[model samples]
Target: MTAPLHPGRFAGKVLVVTGAAQGIGRAVALQAAQEGGAVLLVDRADFLAEVVAEAGASAAGFQADLETYDGAEAAMRFAGERFGGVDILINNVGGAIRMRPFSAFEPEQIDAEIRRSLLPTLYGCHAVLPHLFARGGGTIVNVSSNATRGINRVPYSAAKGGINAITQSLAMELAERNIRVVATAPGGTEAPPRRVPRNAAGETEAEKCWMADVVRQVKQSSFMKRYGTIAEQVAPILFLASDDASYITGSVLPVAGGDLG
Candidate 1:
């Protein structure tokens, strides 16, 4: 079950949620709009229009490839133009594209993993800073992962570790500007099947085993011994992005049922 919504909590705020076509990003965009935020749902996926419709009249959609700086800048600029200015940003555009043992990964595959899981958040944060500054200050909530210490995804792990560092360092630098940077490291989450798979190629037997091991490690590491719901992940993210967490910054809250990765 989802948490109760606090109507008007985000009244008068403009929020940009990357990867808003699905999963936790979709949940965030919908709930934020319900709570009175003017939301810009950003994603490159064609399904983004569906989410925008589901979010009602308060939300708009912007399609962009967040992996590039140009795309990130364009999204933020469009948010500013559409909503007056950005008061919050949820950097949610990332995921591991492949699952395999570190030694088994090709060099190009490793590069792709980093590019997929890291660059969006990096570019999003950089591009949104000026807009947040223009709004006088705002909050940034990055969606990191607790899989940083898990098996068969070293490149993705490194990418999320960089997210932690970005949250910390950027918070320190932006505190004086009244801008807060924070992150949530989510563990295994249960949601509907993806409309777009991370890896379009089929998995081989060996790759399947590697992924199974990752699932095992994730369950064993978490006290809950099960995956969380998409609503579970969305609650904390919106909390951090809201003024309720105004005093919080530079912290990476582990939504991993006690696995502090």
Candidate 2:
């Protein structure tokens, strides 16, 4: 079941949520707006405007490729200008692009995985620092994955591992700065079909089998033996981004049904 929205929980705050065109990012943006936040939804997807409309007057959308530092910086600058300053940043841009055995991955494929699943968060954190500092204090919620310890996507796993390290180290470094850094390691989540499939090319039979294996491993590892709903993932993310979790930082709360990945 989804958690109930706490009206005004985010009153007077400005929030930036990446990958907001769909799925968990979409959920967060709408909920935050409903809770009184002025939200900036960022995505390169064509459907971004739809989410912005759904989020109403309190929300706006920015289209940017977060994989590059320039794109990341541009998004942050736009947010700062539009919202007057940003108080919370949810780095929801990363995802595994392909599912296959490590040996089957070409060198370029590995690079793509790292670029997709790591660089956005890395660039986002760096780009948003000045804005957060300007605000006196803020929160950063990185959406990681429990697949870091599962099968078929070694490069993606390595990327999430990097995020885990970033959360820990950045938290300690910024604690004195009044900025909180944290992450949520989500398990297999049952989201609606993607508007933009991660791998645009149609999957070969071999690739399909490999993906099936990944699904199997994910469910088997989770103590609940099932994927979670998108709401289940978004609730904790908002918690970490809210003042309710003011005392929490440098932590990766696993929303993986007891499979602490």
Candidate 3:
């Protein structure tokens, strides 16, 4: 569903949102556009066009892989050329690439997990920092996961822990320059089924049990004992990106229904 038109909380702003084809990224893009910002939605999926359309005339879409620095730089350039400069950047392009025990993961799988859950944020910040500095300052909201402390995805967890470190260090380093860096650690969120599954192959019973264990642990960890909604996840993210959170920086707000990681 489209977000309701707002009284311009982000009027005259140019925003870039990674992974904006679906889930929390899509929700943030829609809300940012609804609030009068010109939004640029980036993702590897062709369905990004749909989000652009849903976001109305104020939005554009770019298809790019954010896991690589080159891809991240290209996306940032696309935003710069189309929107002049990015006033806000939402780095929401990471997830657990697979569900399995750490001991069961091959070396390649461990590398993939870091690439999928960490590099996008790291490379995104690197690629966009110059533009933000040129503009005097901007807001960067990285989407991290509460799985930083969960099961069956230790590599993914470590990646998010790295994100927490990134948020804190960069915020301090950029404070004098007016750039604010913050993150949201979302608990398991309730959203539509993935159009493209992270792992599409059939799993063995053991693998299925492992994934179930992860889910069980997630629910058990949440104070609310339930997964959060897309809207619930987006609220804190957009707030952190907006003027209301102008005084806040270097913090990772947990939107995990009481699951603070």
Quick one: RMSD of model 3? Answer: 1.6
User: Which stretches of model 1 miss by more than 4 angstroms?
Assistant: none
Residues 1-261 of candidate 1 have per-residue lDDT tens digits of: 985698999999999999999888999999999999999999999989999999999999999998889999999999999989999999998888888988999999999888888999999999999999988999999999998898899999999999999999999999999999999999999888999888888688988888889888899999999888888899999999999999999999999988987
Where model 3 places Cα greater than 4 Å from the true spot, the runs are: 1-6
Global lDDT scores for all candidate models: 0.93, 0.94, 0.90
The segments of candidate 2 whose C-alpha lies over 4 angstroms from its true place after superposition are none
Report the C-alpha lDDT of model 2 over 10-52, residue by residue, as the tens digit: 9999999999999899999999999999999999998899899
lDDT (Cα) of model 3: 0.90
- State residue 181's C-alpha deviation in candidate 2, in Å: 0.2
Alpha carbon deviation, residue 4, candidate 1 (Å): 2.2
- lDDT of model 2 at position 16: 96
> Global CA lDDT of candidate 2, please?
0.94
Q: Sorted on TM-score, highest at the top, how do the candidates line up?
A: 2, 1, 3
Please give the range of 10 consecutive residues that has the lowest summed lDDT in model 1: 196-205
Q: Once all C-alphas are superposed, what RMSD does model 1 give against the true structure?
A: 0.8
Q: Which residue pairs collide, candidate 2?
A: none
Give the per-residue Cα lDDT of candidate 2 at 26.
Answer: 93
Per-candidate clash tally: 0, 0, 0
